[model samples]
Target: MGNRQSVVREAARFAEWVLREVGRELRVARLIAGMTQGQVAGVLGTSISHVSRVEHGLIKGAGLVALSRHAAVVGLKPWIKLYPIVGRPLDRAQLALFAKFRDRIAGTWRVTLEAPMPIPGDLRAADALLAMPGCQCMVEIITRLADFQAQVRMAHRKQRDIGASRLILVVAGNDTNRRAVRDAGAAVRDAFPLDTRATLAALTSGVDPGADGLVLL
Candidate 1:
């Protein structure tokens, strides 16, 4: 029993170490990003003091979710840059794919195509988006597609830039996809086309849009 207690105490200490290190890294990342605590706090729904405390190794129970949100605000989002291998840089094709998305993606809503979804080909399929009753959705789709370079362009597609949104990138030929993620103003979630709602829900419960897009298909 004493030994078990000792192990438990050690585990707790390790966890705390991880949080502190993350907080330290978070502070460094924020500085490099040229973002203020207040700015980051606004995005995370927390106060400047809270961000300061977290950065100073003062947060008591900073969970993974909070850490992720803070990391994103500080621009330390995972896959922001791809290191297929340690100490390795991305190749040209890989760089172009990433740049395509980075340059093309803008506005408040961002859509990434990773996995394919089952949607109808007829106009009826877009009825939901068409029925939005305003130009907000149109602006989002335009901002989304125009942000990237694609062989296939759509005249009309449905999407939105509301927060708490995610999508999969249907990467085909060429390898510039990695750059799309690194240069994003916001987080560009690198996704496999196979990731599904069930899988996403397991990670974090949020809205994920479909990836099968076409202006006229």
Candidate 2:
């Protein structure tokens, strides 16, 4: 009985912390980009209330379609994807692969994470990501990689500087699951000059304690 009480208390504390952290990130990003709440809300096709809920972590559940849209307004490159775990144990390959770009995305970056498998009830992947050392704007991109590709392509076609400032994708996968990602990088590079020199070789299996994949800018 005592343990149960502790667990409940811990869960409540975690929820509160997540809400406060997300609020801080949203506020900071909105300010940094010199964009207003109304403007951000417009981009999201939502009212101030919905955006407020998201920033406050009041959101409880999301579908693939909804997540894709929300991530877009948050101004991160959004994808819809499911992935089985890949890479070496501890599954830090992707982080290592993306290491060279870490510093840029660490603080200002926003992210959308997805789990291919049925996620545990207790694990809020999005919030956990926000808690990562340098993660900011972390949201979950739910569905298939193809969906995510389409989202990015649309953002690229519709927006002036799509994905230039965001660390768009973060799923649990490895080299096998990264082909589409590589192609997307190529497509983005073709359209504009980004820091494309970094390659997968530079990364090692490690965690990016601090990073954000999706962003306002």
Candidate 3:
């Protein structure tokens, strides 16, 4: 319970930090495009104050529609880069593993790496989206498990957008990762069963895994 709350709180803080940085970047983009707040407002069909609020991060939970339109006019594309929850140092190692994992099964599955789903508020970049004959699967790579609850929440959210028949949480093969999975308890298992063999077999055989599961690499 304490772990769950801590995970949720950290996820919320990370989200807030991303929003602040987005606001700052948007302001910089506006400047770079040589557009004032008023100009952006005019293009967005809103008041200059509204544009100012957005630029200043005063607007809460800004949707993708507004963001896309504003960026299109200002010659800036709104994008979010996904980094391991553990931190940037894990980026190269984690991403490489994710790619290799995808490549290993690519002979059988049609895999899309770093697939983007523009879901407002729950925007996520799927590390791998695997498609076989009948099933579409969302594969997420976790080098280190920072937050199980947050990971579950995100997988649930992304499932709708990815339209996956199943979800697989792929974790790096390490002591820390294995311990985190062990500590995740029954609820996490209920959501994502730790069954790498079943997942791999399903991918290889082009059949559905029948439920959410784990893939250890």
Candidate 4:
């Protein structure tokens, strides 16, 4: 009973912390824009009481999407980042692969980890970001092709804001993943052209891949 009580306390604290942080950001934005609570409420199509409740953290279960709409009216863009609390083992392996990729390509392009993306709940983290003389590329390291379509769609949305000249997916050389990609058919192929040889050559020759594609590294 004591342990359960402690866990409940911890959860409540976390919730309060999140609410405070979000409320603070909203307050700051409103102040910066020189907007009154009533004005913000008007824009949001809500009553002044509702806006006050939100600012005071009295509102419960208000999603980021609703907040974002309110923010947009006040010249603010609210972005919330959502990620797994504990990464899977496959994710750890991908990080190692990302390191290898960086080591091999660092001479030619500047590499960064966990790049920013415009989309909410889809942080610009495709393992690594490679910026070169003329173009930038997002590199994704894949060990499995589970939910391949969703992954591609998310990457596509990320590219809209990332301004990546090329999108590269490096699949761990495995039969299962290869077959999965093959089964994805035209959708995957259209998104990522296969240029295994070009990708490998570019890493050595200090040139970017000729086009966006998949490379078995």
lDDT by candidate, in order shown: 0.44, 0.42, 0.75, 0.71
Backbone clashes in model 1: 23
RMSD of each: 20.7, 14.9, 12.0, 6.9
Q: Residue 127 in model 4: shift from native, Å?
A: 1.1
Residues 169-211 of candidate 1: C-alpha lDDT, one tens digit per residue: 3242323433443443233332222232332232232222333
Per-residue alpha-carbon lDDT of model 4 for 1-217, expressed as tens digits?
8866875776566566676667777788889999999999887889998877777776777777887887686777876554421112236878877766666564767777767554542323545678878878887778777888887776666666667888888777679887887788897768777566667667657677767877765
Best by TM-score: 4
Model 2 local distance difference test score: 0.42
- lDDT (tens digit, per residue) of candidate 2 on 1-217: 8866876776676556655555556656666777777888898777888777766767755344664565455554443333222111222544443342344343433333332123332231221122233322222332234654555554333222121222333343445335555666655454323222231111112234222232111
Selected candidate, larger TM-score, 1 vs 2 = 1
> Which scores better on lDDT, 2 or 4?
4
Q: What stretches of model 2 exceed 4 Å from their correct place?
A: 56-71, 76-217
Q: Is candidate 2 or candidate 4 better by TM-score?
A: 4
lDDT for 135 in candidate 3 is: 84
TM-score of each: 0.36, 0.30, 0.56, 0.61
